[model samples]
Target: MTSSTSSSSAPEPIWAVLGASGFIGSSLQAVLARAGITVRFVKAPRLSARSTDPAGILAEAAELHDIRQDLAGDLAGADVVINAAGLATPAGADSPELRGANALLPVVVADAADAAGARRFLHLSSAAVQGHRPVLDESTDVEPFSAYSRSKALGEAALGARKAGACPVTCLRATSVQGAARQTTASLVRIASTPLASVAGRGDSPSAVSSVDALCAFVLAAGRYPGEVPAVILQPWEGATVASVLLAAGGRKPLRLPGWLCRAGLKAGYALSGLLGERLHGTLRRVEMMWFGQRQEPGWAEATANVPEPRVEQVLRAARQQR
Candidate 1:
């Protein structure tokens, strides 16, 4: 989605979204378009799809040089550049290639944004970078264990190193994301659809999910936020736990497994997968995130008044609405 209807009081901001075909980017584009904003789809060659470009503005590139050369016009014209591109477990987390893409691409995008004279750069980071913090905040030192978490932490650090550049930067560290095509939402739907579902593990840890709408809203607000805003921002509100979210989504209470047993299985499975190079039901990263509760400060300065407290019901409703 690239230009917007500017009023006398507020001018619309042009946005260049890297990874425009991904879940977050596509959702953000939809939100921006609804608000009459213009969006530029800065896409990677491997993942670029013509169908994803409703705006018909496609800038395709693969490498760092390719990004700069191909999206030069989009970047130069944009007021906000959002680096929503990254590889995760859902995409492909098996190799060094995905890790490198997640870790290094944000830095490249930030450099391009700086050179292009963009006003603000927002990179979508993850809360897992905080490791096993009981309460996550902006001040928490990153303690990443897994490769995915390390890459995200490194990406944030990369952006921080370039804060003095032409464009001001911020990293929006989202909790687990739910709503629409998101894996979490899909899991919920699957559980709900099943008459009797085997929900593994004791779901005591908080999910700290941000509904796609709420997340998109927060991202939009952060992009347009004043210069006084901090470099890192957490999702607003303390989010729901996995159990509560699942129940709220109308899934029956899962047949519970003992917490200790669950932990043992998770550790054993993760270790086996790593040692044998075998595909497992879930990655170590996913299991760790699920077991380690994500609790954050109540109010996020990055959130606007209009950004609703994300709810599990909202995700269920959004799923139904989309269908």
Candidate 2:
């Protein structure tokens, strides 16, 4: 943990973040460190894929118990527990890893946070909860289609199922978070930067993409929030549209395509994905997001605007630097 305190009587709030080595978690940790906050990182086990085998279940259970016990001790002086661990690779959705990190691990982390009497537990969830929503909100219910989304939804449900306890819980439904360490963002920028343009749904749909900087702002604001935060908060859109992304990437305007053509393409893609199962599910969702986009109404970010986010161009430039 980085000690950012003086001999002053009032000490700064300490943070204990799981998956601190992860792309998003590490970025947030850096921001927290720069802010002179004490942030301790607890490592979670990367267990093998789960199966129907009873032995696998029992083994996983034992591991979870051990992690919970160990983490409680590590969280001694931590005021907030941020769960940024999870299997994010859409390709690995069908694997058992998703269930462990995304589904089972959150509940266990929450347990440890509660056991340690942490002031807050911020769960890093995904907007993938509702795959193709016109507008995503805190009140949005889980209607996941792919394994990755399902696992995330399951985690949220499990946490909700638990009895209300000491720790105040908040779930951050991150929308298309991108960072320099993310290969996904690199690929996306390459595609978007191509001297081609794509305009769909009247060319007003939000890009549905956000940066690590913005996410960091949200995390800090939520972490240091004075009052009780909402149980669920969607990432506030920063007004980046598909056209804007393309303009930033390639410095050109795109041709407008009919919304019906986009919808038709989506229908066919979904039908093929359904026949194949799971593999293309997340990809199709991303495609839909690119075409139709998703809207996030002003909420928590607006309520707690303590932290400042970098400009969209700065964020995209960082993504461009990604290998």
Candidate 3:
């Protein structure tokens, strides 16, 4: 996506997006560009080193900032601020960097928004906060299972507390977000690409899944909505399973592994990743936890009813182009 100066008459709102290089963040950049919105992206320096490709890393770094030492000062002229930074950790692993980014970043974002005199602060949260419930809504109590979820919950509370009477704050709780393959969803796609991934033993319950376009649209809509509450959840449509998405993406003949076998395979993969001191295969374990551990499904019709329908095919095509 190309970036350009905002028009004087239009006064294109300056959107400061944290984590602008991530799967959601990158897609947001493209979507915002298509919508004619001028945005400035900010990202932590250390995190950029984890990228696999040099070109990708440099491309992301060009529009990012190292938010480690000073965050408020970096977000000076933002009219709207969206924090899409967070960690996707395995169940048992404890990464200090992930913890800080997921738990402490909201406070930083709120402080930066306050300093920048931003009209709205949008914090991207996870649906994992709903725990193992069968269905989740805006009123559902948060019961996080892993460190990532716990940290997100903490950050949400921090943002809420800091948003008392200043700029409005909106905490978006998104469901299983699928789009361009990334460190989080890459393994799942790879496994599905293999001949053995299936839903034989997996639960067939209706789950909530949001496409990348839908997610960006929700963020844009929430930023424009006039409301009194400081927090808002962006749940998507239910009945969207991993199997369904794979089928929709043109998977010819998918395999169906028993649930027990799927779990065991994931356990073995994580063990191997831990032994090798790498992150390549552990992503499978994280996806398994998200699919099985969380039973809650979000309702998104209310938030997205007015928004335009997301071009799922275009999103899938973008993923393929990246590959």
Candidate 4:
């Protein structure tokens, strides 16, 4: 569906969403539009199809240059600003761009928002920040493991460093987010379509996932009800294993591969695919490692139960339609 604004009695607040072209950002755009709020998307470099989808809208509004650049004009009368950009490169990977995007950019965004006189600034974060903490919450000590986790933690720190009450910042650490056409979930679907779908091992990890619609709902609610809801964790109802999600997406039962065996298989698959000039190996292997490496926590499950359920059938039906 195309993005639109809902009609409200009083003039809706002008909202600026950074990274509006990303998976969660795009969804937030649609949610805000439906709330009757007129959105002024601020992206890195404006694109032609800014309002195409949630992500497209954000991409179209990006500043293009460093975020530290003046946004006083851009954010002139914005009532709220939401930063929902992140990166998830594998460990030991060389990713200067990823670091800048995930770690550094948030600081710049915060600075800009402060200068713009925005009353509320919401920072979208990852649940990975909880790291191996058995039980995570706002009070739990943060212990990030992977580069992605570290980046998110750093972003949160930056948000915190900002003088308190200076545009009350709310940090939301979200679990694995799922939706109809997100790259992450699409990759999971692609891996499920392979012959080696049965390679997943020991799928007892209690991981949480959030649907795209639910994520958007949270973002809009945050924008609409800032301070009223300071910060919270968000996850899907009934945490599922990688294997279960694959099965739900129509893949056969995954083969359980031991750690050593899975590593060997990945190496072999990469070598063979390189020789055959085909992309056979699954990219989700990295994700699987992240999921398995970290200790499971129940924070997301506890928090998400309070939030409303998303239209899962609608999302699934949309995926089917695309197929």
Best by lDDT: 2
List candidate 4 stretches off by more than 4 Å.
1-9, 45-69, 86-96, 132-136, 198-205, 226-228, 231-243, 255-306, 310-323
State the lDDT of candidate 3 residue by residue for 255-292, as single tens digits.
Answer: 55677776687778767776665453435534563345
| lDDT for each residue of candidate 1 in 47-109, tens digit (9 for 90 to 100) | 222211112211222234765655555588888898888876632334545444555566667
In model 3, the clashing pairs are 201-259
The C-alpha lDDT values of all candidates are 0.65, 0.75, 0.60, 0.58
Clashing pairs in 1: 1-38, 1-39, 2-38, 2-39, 3-38
Ranking by TM-score: 2, 1, 3, 4
Give per-model TM-scores: 0.77, 0.89, 0.71, 0.70
TM-score, candidate number 3: 0.71
lDDT of 1 at 302: 31
- How well is each residue in 7-94 modelled by candidate 4, as lDDT tens digits? 5678778888877777888887877887788888776422222121223323422544443555556766889887776555434332
- Evaluate model 2: give its lDDT: 0.75
lDDT of 2 by residue, 19-39 (tens): 888899889888887776878
Give the C-alpha lDDT of model 1.
Answer: 0.65
Q: Going through the candidates in order, what is the number of backbone clashes in each?
A: 5, 0, 1, 21
C-alpha RMSD by candidate, in order: 6.8, 3.3, 7.8, 7.9
Lowest-lDDT window of 10 residues in candidate 4?
45-54
